[model samples]
Target: MTAPQRPRVPRRALDGVLLLDKPLGLSSNDALVRVKRLYLAKKAGHTGTLDPLATGLLPLCFGEATKFSQDLLEADKTYEATMRLGIRTTTGDAEGEPLDVRAVDCDEAAVRASLQRFIGEIVQIPPMYSALKRDGKPLYEYARAGQTVEREGRQVTIRALELIACALPDVTFRVTCSKGTYVRTLAEDIGEALGCGAHLVALRRTGVGALTLDHSVTLEALSEATQFERDSWLQPVDALLSTFPQVCLSDDDMRRFLHGQRLKLSSLTIAAEAVNAARVRVYSAQGRLLGVAKPGEGVLAPERLVVTTES
Candidate 1:
């Protein structure tokens, strides 16, 4: 017999998501770059941005996984925040210089009741010191130049806002809300509600979509662990996207799908309303993930096929 040949390793061995329990003092991008280095990932990006002072769940997408991040980014988020009342900062948090201060008396009941007023839908103007853009320049640039511009108020839904503790001017609260809701601005608004100005002192993201801090790993631990340990923390790319329906096809159907051919619906069942002419998860009959498909009317078309035969 001829000498046996060793198989070649794939160019990119890693793919999927990483739920990082980001430490305080690292910007979201900074954490992403470091994690990318740890995995030697060729392509990586975070689903959401976290401020330097905040810490908690930051989902990093690697390889083909980055394509699914948009949906995750839009998912509802939960946060635990501690705000210092009686003072407001220019950057809306502790990073900025103290802009205003006022002494005030506050009670726990009063604080809890005040938080109730902010529940439900409300309009919030983007802060000047934010990354919002105007004339192709970040609003923070204008803020640094002492220039203020008209900012349209955005409707943000707060699912729940509760005061966990109120010790004089320092108050801690938990908020579950839709995407785009700014916790820092909420803190300032809460301070205004309490007849005093306030700024965020400490804030941590507890959950994003279905991923939570409980399932996340710290950067330090991940850095020191073996590849097997690190890979265990990856949530399936589809785990956070269960709301979307899934469609599985047979081998023949998958062949057609790989050729970018559209087929009439038959045995597969997906939410009729969910099956628009858009991309969706595709799998084989054995429940192996193949890729995504675009379905229209009663026809299906493959978008990205992740099928593997040798595996």
Candidate 2:
């Protein structure tokens, strides 16, 4: 019999930040490239990496939004993970071959107690299948060639690790942790404490900083939606940097600031008190975003000018 032809994926400009409800089985970068083509964006990047076995809120930044990736990356992340007990893998997830298996005798109370070990500030050694670099190459590359190397445990905070469900060999938990935490490592450690080996079977990121899965759209939906429809999903660039102080300029001040001139505030009419030359969000008199600015001695000096009066 003749082999059937595989269907080709269509291409389309993916701009702005896309809260991708990424499906399982695709790598984070894979999803980013796919979304990039959809928006025809000149540049694109992802806030964080999600394993192929994981699914959930993967924020894809396009165009000038890529510059804010560092802020998004530093934000805390939340995940809903399923840990399968009685077996351990080299990779720490289901993608690897089983290396060992232990008899499980874990109960709900026991599982909860075991998880407590991971809570608060702790150090964890990342798995071999991780993207952590060693001598300009990913550790997973060495792992594939049957090479094991020394990996130092780095400090990562586990703000909350609660057992959502426990059924002997299978345990589900919600972990709200700091950046760079590996749930797979936590799963293995939990299994070891319970006298059983375990590995992560499923994982889904529920939130990243302020962005949540609730505000995300799936790739399937994006593929069917038009450019105009897709553009509606973009939250303003300022939305990502809400932590900065805001400054509302008068009409004349806005004009002066846009024309490469500084606004001298001798009396300090800003809404924020105690402003001493810090980066602030600049907006027009009509409440339109102008961009970020740095305040000097009685003057508003723009450091990173984005939009101007013409814009």
TM-score of each: 0.87, 0.84
Predicted structure with the largest lDDT when compared to the true one: 1
Find the 10 residues in a row with the least total lDDT in model 2. 302-311
Off by over 4 Å in 1: 1-11, 270-280, 293-296, 300-311
Q: Tens-digit lDDT track for model 2 on 71-115?
A: 779888999999999999878988888999888876788888888
Candidate 1 lDDT over residue span 1-311, tens digit each: 99889985344556688889999999999999998877777788999899899999899988767877887789999999999999999988999999988987777887888899999999999899889999999999999999999999999999999878878789999999998999999999989998888999999999987778877899999989997787788877666556656887788876677677887775556667547635678877888766677777677766665534532
Q: Name the lDDT of candidate 1.
A: 0.84
- How accurate locally is residue 241 in candidate 1, as Cα lDDT from 0 to 100? 55
lDDT of each: 0.84, 0.82
RMSD of 1: 5.9
